[model samples]
Target chain A: MTPIKGLVLAAHGSRLKASNEEVTEFTQVLASSLIDQYKHIVPAFLELAKPSIEDSIDAAVAAGCTDITVVPYFLAAGRHVREDVPEIIEERQKAHPHVTIQATPHLGVSEALKQAVIHLL
Target chain B: MTPIKGLVLAAHGSRLKASNEEVTEFTQVLASSLIDQYKHIVPAFLELAKPSIEDSIDAAVAAGCTDITVVPYFLAAGRHVREDVPEIIEERQKAHPHVTIQATPHLGVSEALKQAVIHLL
Candidate 1:
């Protein structure tokens, strides 16, 4: 089997189901585009939603992904990004020390997104 | 005086000053690029921080802006985006009906952001 890599789009979940769905919907689009790079594009939330970060990471490992990158779908590196996420990743690392779990930077100070918003405005 | 158009980056405020500062940093970069389009770029919050959405909008109007666009810096169109933001905008509209107040879409389901993440990965 080909060594698979998972790309987890981590988000701060909300009580509203629609809010959680947004991350899934976004992951679908991102997965389609990133099919070549990452085999699994999972959307995980911090709280108030399903597919908790731990569960998503487990699923990624179960799916045979040797490398997993948890990309925070956050606009800034706040408490959730700085603290909560690292705690979860640390626990997961102990569980699956073999898997190379990586967490990417939050969505702050981006020229591309800034331009996109400018064009959007 | 050149008529200013304020681009308010409406975000969910955090108790942590660093979290709120992230939006300010992002806005500074965004503002530099958008200086030609918008006269001022303000950062507003829904709760738990200074510069409430109302205050930011009021500043925009006071600064001689005829048009103001309140862009939600949210990743999802959840309760805050769907209900809280609209309610605030409606009230602001009543106060300054002359100022063309517009709310742009949230940051979910974005192709540009998706591609940016993919490239970053």
Candidate 2:
């Protein structure tokens, strides 16, 4: 059983171009750091921007990933994280039933982020 | 001059009660750690919830803070951060002309958070 075949860094894309670009910029940083561990690391948007979650999932599968983990770059487990993202993934699953998709908790609850924010202050 | 007289860990409150609560929960963690440095640390909402930016600003002034900092707990500097939040702070400034109200960049682009996400991956 291979572990963490692919990783998707999903964000709630913004309407403002600058705001959305920041997510893409941060994703590049993450993609670089994660290159050693993950074969396919992609940045995707939930809405209001390019590369919606479904497209990201398709890319992962196209890159020969059978099992993928989608980590929402959101602050909390909102409906988008809890419901919307999963629904998108589910639809993708219909096309690639062999693939295994997992969703991680949003970045909001990550203790690492909590500690980081504290350190930032 | 008082250094960081007060702090507001501001969030884009969600329609989902659970999602909005997570911001409050994170704010408590931030408040607990920041209490030593800041006399007042408040959790405020940008919209869709209670104790908005204006109310939080009022509270900070009421707490005897002359120079206050509002830190947006958002992933990026969207229209809300670039326009809406500044407008709110401007209104508050008008109400409390003597108080020094400042708005920090949103939580996005923080090297600390970038490091945290890298470690998390």
RMSD of each: 1.8, 2.0
Show pairs that collide, candidate 1: none
TM-score of each: 0.94, 0.92
Q: Across residues B1-121, which tens digit of lDDT does each residue of candidate 2 receive?
A: 7554898878888889999888888878877767888898888898888889899999999989988888877888888889888999889999999989988767776667777676555
All models, DockQ values?
A: 0.68, 0.61
Q: Provide the lDDT at A69 for model 2.
A: 83
Fill in the DockQ of model 1.
0.68
Q: Which one wins on lDDT?
A: 1
Superposed Cα deviation of residue A8, candidate 1 (Å):
0.9
Top of the candidates by DockQ: 1
Model 1 per-residue lDDT at B53:
96
Candidate 1 recovers a fraction of native contacts equal to 0.61
Candidate 2 Cα errors over 4 Å, as ranges: A1-4, A119-121, B1-4, B118-121
